[model samples]
Target: MNEQLTPRQLMILVAYFIIGTTILVVPSALAAEAKQSAWILQLAGTGSGLMLIALYVQVFKRNANSNLFQINERLFGRWIGKGISLTIALLVFVFCAQVLYYIGRFVTTQIMPDTPSEAIHVLFIITVVVGMRMGIPSIARTAEIYFPWVLLLFIFFILFIMPDIRVNQLLPAGEFESMSLVRGALQVMSYSFLPMFVTFASLNAAYDWRSSMAKAFVYGTLLSGVMLTVLVMVSTMVLGPDNTTTQLYPTYVVARKINVGNFLQRVEVIVAFLWFILIFIKLILYFDVVIMGIAETFRITKHAKTLTVPVGLLIAIFSAVVYPDYVYQQEWDNTTWVAVALLIGLAYPIALLFLSLFRKRKAAAK
Candidate 1:
């Protein structure tokens, strides 16, 4: 693995990873709680996300050249750190399965209703496994390649849907309950930001974590945050809060409204394509970090690729039962996921940083 990712590539990966499943699910999720003020929740979430990225940058600064697994070992000693690393790896593995389930479900319900979700899971997992086998350089490069197309499609989606936006849809904005806004913001952070803990593992692939790289990280978050905010806001204004809340993928539905002269109609596939790019990048990155974390935890550097197929198979199996039903999924996303994301993405890093400072002080005294 003599691979290195440029800052530009890192930026693209971060942006795509943040935008991944968020583009589809967020509008409805936010609308459910915040209603017309859903976009405000997104703004707050994104702001907090930038703050988290700053914290991550500090963590990376303290533990330069080491991935999250190695950082755990360095901060907590060998066995305990390995235990922690393995746990995090397993959590990410579960996330991979969840993402796989998301894509499979999306396709079955939205695109190909006749196709079995299991088939979609298997097919998508194969691509992820293949991408992982190619290593991070390839994955980063692929993201860079797809970045422009994603940006263009998103811009076009916003532009074409402008005509359908109803200002009155957002007329009663800022009228939500305080708890509802808090919950909505937390949900947005849980889905769009907190899972970025995986990026700590990816930092090892970067050429350098210099200031430029740090800026790239923030830039990625900002770009994705703006895109998500706009998407959420537009969904509410165009589809109304009621429609956005009721639909599973309000953004996808919004795409159906892109009718420029009727000739440019029925381009909902563009939304799907954009999501596939973002989701695939995110899925592969998750899979990559899972493999890396496990290998580093066990010192299996030479044969990490060997674990790919077995891992892929397990993810596929897990996808089959990740959710008992969509109702359960919604419950899990709103409630369970926030706690889980906070644990892994927020609390875990803070713990490591505190330990790092404690060790530094002890060493200084010695």
Candidate 2:
């Protein structure tokens, strides 16, 4: 028996997943490539992402009572629908692992330089597993409680770091290249919101499927885009593009620069604290989706208890082995892999929309 989530719970899950660790990494990375135009890329990416969301909305609107798994079964027939469901489940598993890996690596390298990546990974996994075992309602409740603190901390961090920002450093005033911005935005769209398709699909099974999903998506995108744009602009102003490109954690570096008189020095600790909370929320949401997905596919009754340890172990092992080093990972992300992601994330939904339409028309003619 699958449990249904309320609309408020669904909204929190969407918001938390959308705002995860990517918030920490993306601004610096996009700024490195797009520079002052990074915000433009983010805006363009959000627009492109919304188009994909529309396709998803169309599918859900057509079959408002069914989840993606059920929709797949209807659209593709029994065997193929099962295959599609498994494929989506596997993708969510891999995504969850990769997110955990990235968070562990970030913690080890940036905040606690002395801590082993394995130790960090284990601790992170433990926290996520505990949350997943508690069920979706618990996770949603946790977010509601912590969300205000997360927002407050983010505001404080941004304000405290503003004093260190050098406005002149933000510009030699380069020409705006529209094409480059579009390309960069396309890249972001591939990685960021596309993953949310799976989550949205999963949640649709349990929530009231309608325009509300689209509303949540738009709100989440706008919130994430604004934060990312501010982070990029601030990092550019403080570190300059050339230097920002070379740095590992440009936002962290910017946070380290905060110095308010003699009293408020060493505020990077606070930044790390806030980021840890966000990352934990992200990990838990992904873990929840993966567990729920596996249970739904296999027709299991008690999902929360059954799959927790196995998935955690799988993520731990895979995260350690996913990349030889950060450079290789970055290269893979920037090159052909992201293009493949765009196809899966963006193109796949559009294909489904067309197929659904053709099916409807043929049935109507008959």
Candidate 3:
């Protein structure tokens, strides 16, 4: 039985995945370099991301019925394609660990200070693994089910926080250093856009991959990008660039400032809840990518579900060691992660698409 995801489900998944880790820390990441003009950098990054999606659309058009692993095998041939697929699986697995760590660290630091991050990692991955076992349709349906609540909470978040948005805080905008803006934009793409390459792993499951899928990808990305830009601008406006850069999760801190009539107080939980949903969806999606890639590469579909728990355990363990300290994670994010994301998310797809075109031309010539 083939599982099918609707275009709407795909759109929601893409938006939630792109907004995953980005909405929480993007303010600080952008403000650190772009300063008062971080929102502008976000807009730039979003634009760049949209353009990159065009390239993915081309690749998808070439093999609308094949998942990423199958495409790799088709384009690169059996041995080389399987090797590349395995590498992708390994890389995504590492990223999955990092995201798990992010969730664990966030909960322990902001909400449950005394709780062990490892504990959170284990618990969270257990849930994600369960989702994986249910398959893509179930996962997408779950996202659809939660979409309206997430939207409602987001509206409330913005409405309440509007009063605290001081125009003076963004006064020094447009005075950004060019290199700083470039760096900030790259950071945003690394976290939000580049990682979207993972979506290709599931696009084949979409009911309308050729037409509606492209529209879904474009719209979903635009929605998330706008949402992220708003969050960054609001954070900078309310928290100031200095404070925004200093805090680990600036958007969460901004949520603390939302108070309506002093009656609706202590609503930072809204931000936490939002982050939890986005992060979980993103994490599970990445986990699915890892599973599908490995299963396809190794011809282990029969045992994929049974291996889910062990893979989840490995992710939980790796989350502890992905970075020794928070400082190291930040450093890696600013430097190493951008390069890694570009290599897999940008270079890999472009190479695949070009090779595919060449192969088609050769066949046509024959």
Candidate 4:
């Protein structure tokens, strides 16, 4: 908890942040819009991500000595900064709850159909709450340790599923409405790229002097983008865009297809577990960010852990009631979540960067 994140840790954190729930849900999300062109449209998201990485890295480099709290206060003044911080915290809290919902919904529907969603939700939230209460370094370290296993499993999954990809499935990229393609790209960016922007407020993962956070973030985004592109391609090829779109968890469905001479069958559960691990990492990171934000807003300098249990309790109950089912979740993800993510992730950072630059020039002119 007391340790600072290294370059490697920062890169891993960003990768996991982007990968979070994006991998689990992206196939269906993209298929709904772009269909067979889901692969190409996802690559478009990398462009959006590169643009965001540049803006956020500038923020990170300029405010190396300050956390997001101090940077916001310095840039926007106290009242506005507090308001901004509260918004960021709320987003983080909601995101945490969403991630938990993903775990519960996945487990209940796929693995443990008879198990109560509330039971799964409580068990999962407890893990994240404990890890988060430890501190930023703890969260970063957890990412560092598990990232390799995730990378290996993901790559192996892609390889094992390679023989299943059909070239014809990804064809007909030109037929879709360009607006639909554009919308698909936006959804990809919202899921993959914008997370990079939101996490700037979680700069509690605060980089050490030896590492360049901007460079680490660029590397991480590129790697995660590549992974996402491959996943989209694979999903479209193996499952066909139609199947991918219809299945609620297409990636998990795709994973169920792994079989090499029947020796490596039923390994889809491994992929499912990996997704759960990724969700845990995601939820914990957001949980820590919200707690830190609240403490900063109220000037709770010490013993912030006191707030953890109650907040965790709130998150648990909230997750249970957020959406009655996955349909409502899908609706929110498609509509309201976009505006929320863009406001906090895109608009806020860009505005802050402009203000910081303007203020610097004003000071210089003075």
Question: What would the TM-scores of all predictions be?
Answer: 0.97, 0.91, 0.97, 0.95
Across 1-366, the per-residue lDDT of candidate 3 in tens digits comes to: 127678898899989998999887688988988778899999999998998889888887787777888888888999999998889889999999999989998999999999999999999999998888987788888999999989989889999999999989998779888898788878888998887886555446444664588899899999898889888888999999899999989988888988899898899998799889999999988988888888888888767777788889899999999988999998898889999999987998899889989999999999
**Candidate 2 per-residue C-alpha lDDT over 31-96 given as tens digits, one digit per residue, 9 for 90 to 100:** 766775566666677778677767767766776667677677778887887788778777777777
User: Tens digits of per-residue lDDT for model 1 on 132-209?
Assistant: 898878988889888889889989999999899888888787988989877877877788778987654545545486
Q: On residues 211-248, what C-alpha lDDT tens digit does candidate 4 reach at each position?
A: 57668888888888888888888888999989999988
Off by over 4 Å in 4: none
Query: Candidate 4, TM-score vs. the true structure?
Result: 0.95
* lDDT at position 4, candidate 1: 61
Model 2: worst 10 consecutive residues (lDDT sum) = 1-10
lDDT of 2 at 104: 79
**Candidate 1 deviant stretches above 4 angstroms:** 205-207
Q: What value of lDDT does candidate 3 attain over all alpha carbons?
A: 0.86
Residue clash pairs of candidate 1: none
